[model samples]
Target: MIEILDPAQLPRARAVGALVATILQTAKARCQVGTNLLDIDAWTRSMIEDAGAESCYVDYAPSFGRGPFGHYICTSVNDAVLHGLPHDYAVVDGDLVTLDLAVSLDGVVADSAVSFVVGQGRPEDTAMITATREALAAGIAAARPGARVGDLSHAIGTVLRAAGYPVNTEFGGHGVGSTMHQDPHVPNDGRPGRGFKLRPGLLLALEPWVMADTATLVTDADGWTLRSATGARTAHSEHTVAITRDGAEVLTLPPAA
Candidate 1:
């Protein structure tokens, strides 16, 4: 179901967004060449508790996932891309890690993700990161009020395709608000003017994820995890946003130090 937040509800959404941004930034910064995946998850738990916010993933059990997420955050390293459950492993130098997070503040939800290389990494990894960011920005630019969801998807595809990367449609953005995942599943590629229409008060998470060379995706041994079809590198970036009369507002910006 799609949810449109009244203007009054936007303040809460912004607060929730801030929390997500803060948590993600904090987690990403602490993640290093030798950081442990379990430690990252624990740190996420601490930050959420400190903020008095609830984890959108802790008990989340979508049809695609195994029962309850049972983790504080998603720590996807190297080949692992989406729904990467935090595990008992330490990140080594050159590992490309993606931290995806979603949380709720006063019942409002905010979701975001960031992909970065650990310990200086490889040239290819750096390039993949830049491409994903460009794709994400393109998608957001096409997300103003009155633009079709397909317009956003197509914009994302155009950027990725031009960058010489393949798009993944199995997963993309989705309606977000009081709930982590909601209506109008935004695919990475589609015909412009197709799918749902955009309007003020609508909240959506526009995520663009791509692997270095393949369009296909493979599920990892863990039922919830998704990886690139090719054994190549990957990157993903996302943000939670609120649709406004003028345009969409990106709610999850890191707090000013």
Candidate 2:
């Protein structure tokens, strides 16, 4: 369902956005070489509980995924990209990790994701992460009151293609408001003038992700983690944005250090 949040609801939306951002940032900070993936999930749970926010992931049963995600956060490592279920694994130096999170506070929801190297960074991995981040920025910049969803998708696709990465259309951004995922599916690539028109109070989670080599994906035995078909490394970046008269307001920016 598409939800145009009321002005009064925007504040609650912002609060939930802030909470999700802070939790992701905190998880990123705690991630290091030898850190267990389960630990990261635990940390996320504690933070959300402390803030009195509900996890939009845990217990989440969507048709695309196995029922009940049963985790507080998504910890994608190396070849893993989306729906990465936390498991018994420890991060190592040079590992590229993506953390995706969504939470509800005061009855509003926000979602965001970030990809970064765990310890000593690999140049190629760093470049991939940068590309996704740039693409996400481009997508958000295209999210204006009069712009179409395709404009945002085109902007994102342009950045990724310019960076020499193949775009995947299966999973992309989507409308977000009272629910984690809603109508107006925002693909990573599309015609600029086509698709749903943007309006004030529309909230969208724009994500851009790419694999180092192939665009194809393979599901892990766990039935949740999605990895590159060729075991190529991947990176993902995302943000929850609100369309307004002025432009897009990014609600999931990490808190200032």
Local distance difference test, per candidate?
Answer: 0.89, 0.92
Query: Poorest 10 consecutive residues of model 1 by lDDT?
Result: 220-229
Per-residue CA lDDT of candidate 2, range 102-169, in tens? Answer: 99888889999999998789889989999999999999989999999999999999999999998898
What TM-score fits each model? 0.97, 0.99
Q: What is candidate 1's local distance difference test score?
A: 0.89
Candidate 2: residue pairs that collide: none
RMSD of 1: 1.0
lDDT of 1 by residue, 1-257 (tens): 88888889999999999989988898888988789999999999999989999898889998888859899898888888899989989999888999999999898999999999888778888888888888888888889888999999999899888889888797999999888999989998778999899999899998888888898878877777788877777889998888898888999878888
Which 10-residue span in candidate 2 carries the lowest summed lDDT? 58-67
- For residue 102, model 1's alpha carbon misses the true position, in angstroms, by 0.4
